[model samples]
Target chain A: MSASVSPDWIAVDWGTTNLRAFAMQGGTVVDQAQSDQGMGGLTTDGFEPALRALISPWIAAGNLPVIACGMVGSRQGWVEAAYRAVPCTPLDTVLTRAPASGGLAVHVVSGLSQAAPPDVMRGEETQIAGFLQLNPGWDGVICLPGTHTKWAHLSAGEVVSFQTVMTGELFALLGQSSVLRHSLDPDGWHDAAFAEAVGDTMAHPERLAARLFGLRAGQLLQSTDGAIARARLSGLLIGSELAATKAYWLGQNLAILGTGAQARAYRDALALQGAHAIPADTDRATLAGLTAARRLLREAT
Target chain B: MSASVSPDWIAVDWGTTNLRAFAMQGGTVVDQAQSDQGMGGLTTDGFEPALRALISPWIAAGNLPVIACGMVGSRQGWVEAAYRAVPCTPLDTVLTRAPASGGLAVHVVSGLSQAAPPDVMRGEETQIAGFLQLNPGWDGVICLPGTHTKWAHLSAGEVVSFQTVMTGELFALLGQSSVLRHSLDPDGWHDAAFAEAVGDTMAHPERLAARLFGLRAGQLLQSTDGAIARARLSGLLIGSELAATKAYWLGQNLAILGTGAQARAYRDALALQGAHAIPADTDRATLAGLTAARRLLREAT
Candidate 1:
């Protein structure tokens, strides 16, 4: 298969379960595509073919400079990129050119890792870079909530340290799989119940490990409505995360980076804690980061 | 139905999903029986016949005093016994006699509840009562790890405010239904991997929500052996539980009350945490609780 030379560059945000690609001409995405061919998917089917298939239409149109982030840089991704250890700045971001295939220049981004409890982030580094590009002079905390909610502490354009909370994924698992699932009303948010639970959890956050059982008991005893129980459980989790990250957000400029539905919930939660949650464009940031990396590569050349 | 003359008391531990009865002669259980007449099942079948059938054998011999616990005390149960609020002693335990049923004394135990962020326990109170009887002067925590793991802090004869964790039910649900379950080895526990995961989780306990995706990622990337991944995920949850409850067991004596295969796992986990875990007799404890409640009633009369 031959690669065409139409699009100037390709920006990819590849994560554990999904692959997203944007075709950029003069640093703006002209066309977008996505596939189930995430880093997770490629682990079984192999990397090259999956990447080729996802961007085949763009690739067929033109030979483009490709910048990819996320698990594609993990030991299990298409190719392993060495982790950039933290206190990472824009300059510290590791960039490696991919093997030229069908006349395309592919650059895979390096994942970031911290030594102290040995935490790591793959695609999020790109998001952080994108965040930095938009809010150039801003410095404080950027919280990206998801399965692994990242709380990054930025100082002088550098990511000094960050903490990740497993809030979203835990809620999904508990709500869908556990007995608590029976008690959850997933359709709407019960603010009163949620607030009550969040307040209780904030007061005695340690009790979260214990209070989960109350969902089943409350349902059986009719003391708690299904919707309220679900809300309470969700509140307990979000509250615990809030307690852990309170020191990071207290009296600091806080920005929350999220997409669509999750972002809305996070915004509501941040308000409860009296923190400013400015929604950063997740897609825009990924493209901006890729463009920034591409320009850096071009400038060096 | 006519009541038999001066029948010995029959004890019942009718819970949400199952009903168990004991024919007590003096202080010993001379005959034992069980029925699928769980509160869940009785909700459709009506409570009267279900209760009669469960103890018909013992009833045929003599009209026995039936003492019940668990969901049998709920509005959905045979009768509602009302909730006994927290910081409550055994004397504070609500014991309600069954409504007019021909000289038959059916006393149902009350469920326990906390204040705001209300948590409640029904079957557990009986278990706690049984534990108190067995260890008269003991002062420590009795952990009943199950669908809803209960951690009771006992001082003298009173049950101090205890907490409940939904560990077991969560494990079962995530293992059987969640997306991660697809990547599990399905062959059961892999000890080395499980232990490693437990250790890793203890170190970075907060990553629990995100680390879950790794199961699916590993399966896709082929970086993780499916079997090992499953065990590792299980270990991660167990480890998280251990971390969450560390303070609960740190300086206090720990005794795990469980039975059969699940009990063995709890034993291993307790050992890992350097806590003393004794397999309390589950059947014996239930029987003992019913017997103790009966004696208290007869003595009060």
Candidate 2:
């Protein structure tokens, strides 16, 4: 197939399990495409082919700068993009640009990491950079809820400090794979149970282990609906996260960057605590981040 | 395939994934056989076939009593063996006898369930009943650690109360399926790291979410050994469980009824907390429980 559009730049967010590319003519998005050919699905050599396949139609006559984010930059991904330690500007952070091996100029944006306690994030940093680019100089907390939900503190236009919670992953595993799966209704949800569980867990998190089993017991004994079980399970995990991250969310300017139901869940969770979180589009944030990174590359040349 | 050996009575412990039958001429186990035809792998009508396949020779001259326990009694199992409510004697608990089918006397032991802050245990109850039989009049707490680890309090031969934690399942899902899989050596383990994680989590149970992510961060930034990561993962999970169940373990005469490396890990974790836990064989517990229940059936008849 011939090139669909003559691309000036390419915006790619290659995560562990997903590869998304937005072809740009000038500085605007002209065409976009994605594939399941993520870093986790490819070896060291598979990254280039996977990328080319997704954006093959976007290939221009000249070398097109491809600004990529997410796990595609990890040591286990295409090219090893070392993380820039925190207390650094998310946008100004060092970018690991892989040399043009073919017709593509690949720049893998560096992720961010924390010292002392030790924490790291790969693709989320780019999203943060994009969020910062759009919001500019807006300081406080930005809660990015996803598989490894990130809470970043931004000030002086930099990620001051951040934390991550495995809430989404835990929910997926417990809901679908664990014994809790028996009692959970994957398609059903009860908001009241969710709010109650959030409040209860946040109050007494020491009972986490006990309460998790309660979901099953309640289903067997009290004839509790699976919807309640699913909601409570989600609430308990997210609630516990909120309890631990009280330092980050309490009395702060909060905005949640997520897409679809997950973002809504986080927004609802925050509302339960009397904190109204402004919702932002995650895909838009990624596109914006990639666009900004490509601009940085242009200026550098 | 012919009968390996003739049998008198059969001792069966049919779990979710495995079926083991001890052909007993008397109280002594004369021959032992097992199959992968656990309840989870069979349907209601398939149970009889599965049993006969495991112990075809043990059919005997007459209808030999086959006492079974565990998730084999679950609603989804062969026959719906209802759960006996708690605050009852573990050994003297009710046994649901399935009707004579295919010339086999099959009796499925009832699992225990707790009310108020509900909780349930299917297989562990049998293990507890067995533990109680051998350690007659022995009071205090017995911790049976597995996929869903159970902690039961015994007083005056009655299982006063119990709680379950999904620690093993959580560890398995996180290590094998979650993002932490990257930083983990699935086959590796370290004692010191495990102990340290146990102590840390136990001391600060509130930091559970934060500490969980630390496992991944430590691996990436600190070049942490996978063994340490594995041990720490186990420690963090088990430690948090202990912290929640502190009411049951602290200053309590505790015995860990488990087997293999996981049991040993529990022993080590307890030892770190200035508590020396006595280890008991899980198989022996199941066998003894079934034998005791079978004898009770005979006396009642």
Candidate 3:
């Protein structure tokens, strides 16, 4: 808690819309801070200054070893950390060193990419690595629900393959921008409505486009509650995603990674289909993954 | 057309973001005008002023009967014209009259609504009516592609049932507002890519949410052209819609009403499936439908 005491290394999770930094002392998070200056907003030159602004107070005499992940390592990030092709371990031993200001020595963790399906992930690879770290040799699927939800097939300490579903993003766009926006209340939810919609869509996923307008139509004709509509919308998308990835989660050892409602919704949706998923903390996964990346760097060197 | 040339009647096509007025002189359009003052922008009081701004010059001492359709008849429009429940004619013999300024008498044509599966259409009903008027005793499906694409089953001069698919809106939202926005060129198109994507999704509609991210991923990994990505996005959504509405168009008398790129895409997609759809013009449908409403008004008087 004391500013005078310096951290051994800093862990950074620089994503599209937010930058999160954690001061790590012997693999434990000593202090954590976040900023709005994420990878999407910053130019190449702006990254170091943005990083310095947040972690400046914790900097000491010796150069602080900063391990970063997510979009910060993307092509548009501070430095391009080429994605490591998957069917390999989530974390690569070799780290991409980045230019940093005085008192900071930065290394970026590479993302994972799949060629056949043409999918790429940055932040989630680190999270997967952390999950694997906590449960060494864990096999099966690790579902990460967020703006761009990723379903990774893990086996024998390697990410076999993964699929990305833009469910969260679709939900946001439809609920905020599309005609459905009028019928959906941002902060409303109905458990029964959600469950029913998930069941319906999973049974007939092709009818999703037809069902979307029903949310608005229902509100207009039957005076359906906005909360119910919102829940149904969420359920419909999640159900469609579930229907698509039936090969990934059906009868597989499943664990959903995240501490957010999106993760919870996914877990609940799967539960409706009689599949139980283990809940994993996102922050813990990110921190543990970053720590694992740092270990990999040390081993490679 | 001169200022002295007054219209026998005015046909109004008012939707969410647009208000179009056609000067109809004995069933022919003498002149046409439009404004951004759509139903979405105007209140009860604002509608008359907005309507007058474009048609004030055409107003004469004799009252001009205005027949209106679309969102202008919605609850939020100038006057609420209650939806005429379907399993009946698309155009009702009765029309709801709205309060208007001197020298202008306005009548709102009722939209069609289905009770079960719950759906509603305002302006499209007019198009369907127009189509029905032109092709009297025609039975089968009428597909109107737009922001809210409609597929209606017509039999015995009545709309047996109808469904609305938000495919167009989804395409717009994903291409313009979602992460796919980065990989899609607004004006780009790839015919082969679109056809392939349509086939892929028609075969696997459940994978839609998953495939959406591929547009961006394909760009990131394979340097896929934005135009190709754009076409693929459109194809994916339309393909999903087609997959859902297989019941409506498979081995049925199909007529597509619209004279836009979207309508053309729908026809092409259907053609890919070996279903030949007769192309119909949207403006003609709307005008014909409004004229039918005017005829009904005259008969009622």
Candidate 4:
């Protein structure tokens, strides 16, 4: 399609397992679209087709400068975006622009990596940038919990360093695939059970691994309540993660970037750990980051 | 086929996932046999044929009494052997015998169940009985670790009560199905890392579920060593199970019933928990249980 006039610019926050796109006019998103056709899905189907399907309507209107973040820039992404080192902020950094096609100026954002232990992230860097953009002049610890949960330290608009957690994914696997599935009531959390487990784990963490076996044993011994066991297991794992992260990024103001159930859970956990948590809208931050990238391109030209 | 002057017996241990059989002459195993036709496998292959295949050799020799235990008594096993309540010892009970063609006596052992929290055990009862027989007057704790690991409290040749742990199966599912697999480095255990994680978990036991996210975070932050992360995860889970068991059965003499690598792992873990563990020969116990069943049959008639 030939470009007649510039349509509203769009920003896409695509990650390994989630794809979300936002329509931006001026500096805010007017409309948004989402699909499960994340980067992980594109590995099976080529990336171009997936992108085309996601934004066909916007593309048909006119060519738009689309800035994307998340897994779309990984080695496994549509195109590999270089990694920015730690202690870098999103505002000063410009996203890498892909070769423009069909009047679409596409920019795939770079993720961040640390060299010491060779840790890396692809899509979260932009989100971190977005988080820093919104919470300017804030220096503290921010946790983004999901399939791969991130605990980041930011100071003076820069992402100093971050840690990742696999809590959600582990819960899913254990719940769905293990024999413990038989014991999980799945109605909701049992507070007493959860609290007891958390208290027990916090007291004697070394027994954490061995204690997992107790779930099945409790059932066999006629001493276990399935719902309680399920909640307890959940508590043990989540509590252990919190303790580890505490050790890594201690004595920092903590902000949690998530929404709904998971965010609430994190809030409760942080409270138990005596850490204050403030919730930041992750989706909005993603859009803002992409919007900033588009504005940067416009100003450059 | 006619009845032989020598008494013939068939022994079967039908577990959830596997079925094993032994042909015996004069209280000695003549030849051993097994099939993948476990209770789990029998979902498709009905009961009669499964039993026939297991004892086909003995069927060819002459009609014999077939004694069985494990899942064969569950709703899914060959036949549901009604559960006998706890406080009952092995020698105090014998399975109900069904007379089959050619004078074969098919005896399906009864499982033990508890009413309070409503837990049950089938095959393990026989193992417990066999263990009791071998030790004669031993008392304390016996742990059988597997997809459904069992921890039993025995007193005066009686299995007082037992608990189960779904440790092995959970490990399999997490290692194979979860995204954690991508981050796992399974070379060997990292002591410092494992100890740190264990310590952290003990301090904040409630966070075990939430802490799982830190596995990914540790990988991303370059703070977690991959190989150690895997072992650490294992430690967290196993350690949790041990902690729970300790709460219920602490101060009891401990004996572990398992073979090969799993047994070794448990031995080490129990040591960490300050529990001295004696390894019980699982395979020998299986054979001993079968032999004891034969003795009981001869004495009955």
Candidate maximizing lDDT: 3
Q: In model 4, what lDDT does residue B291 have?
A: 71
Once model 2 is optimally superposed onto the true structure by TM-score, how far is the C-alpha of residue B186 displaced, in angstroms?
2.7
Per-residue error (Å), model 3, residue B204: 1.7
Model 4 C-alpha lDDT per residue in residues B28-132, reported as the tens digit of each score: 666777778778766534766777866775677557668887777776566667778777775434666643455667788787776643456667777777787
lDDT of 1 by residue, B22-63 (tens): 777766776667777789776634766777776776777557
| Candidate ranking (TM-score, best to worst) | 3, 2, 4, 1
Best by DockQ: 3
Say which prediction, candidate 1 or candidate 4, comes out ahead on TM-score.
4
For model 2, how does the per-residue alpha-carbon lDDT over A127-219 read when each residue is reduced to its tens digit?
Answer: 887888888888989999988899999897789999999998899889998888989999788999999999987888777877798898899
**Docking quality tier of model 1:** acceptable
Best by TM-score: 3
| Least accurate 10 contiguous residues by lDDT in model 3 chain B | B55-64
User: Regarding TM-score, does 1 or 2 come out ahead?
Assistant: 2
Which of candidates 1 and 3 reaches a greater TM-score? 3
How far out, in Å, is residue B252 in model 2? 2.1
Fraction of native contacts, model 2: 0.75
**Mind giving the per-residue lDDT tens digits that candidate 2 earns over B180-248?**
888899798898999999998788777888778888899889989988999999998889888889899
When summed lDDT is taken over every stretch of 10 residues in candidate 1 chain A, the lowest stretch is A1-10
Which window of ten consecutive residues has the lowest lDDT sum in model 4 chain B? B1-10
Q: 1 or 4: which has the higher DockQ?
A: 4
lDDT score at residue B37, model 4, on the 0-100 scale? 76
- Model 1: DockQ vs. true structure: 0.25
Where does candidate 1 stray beyond 4 Å?
A: A1-6, A44-46, A90-105, A192-200, A214-231, A268-274, B1-117, B132-147, B151-162, B167-281, B293-301
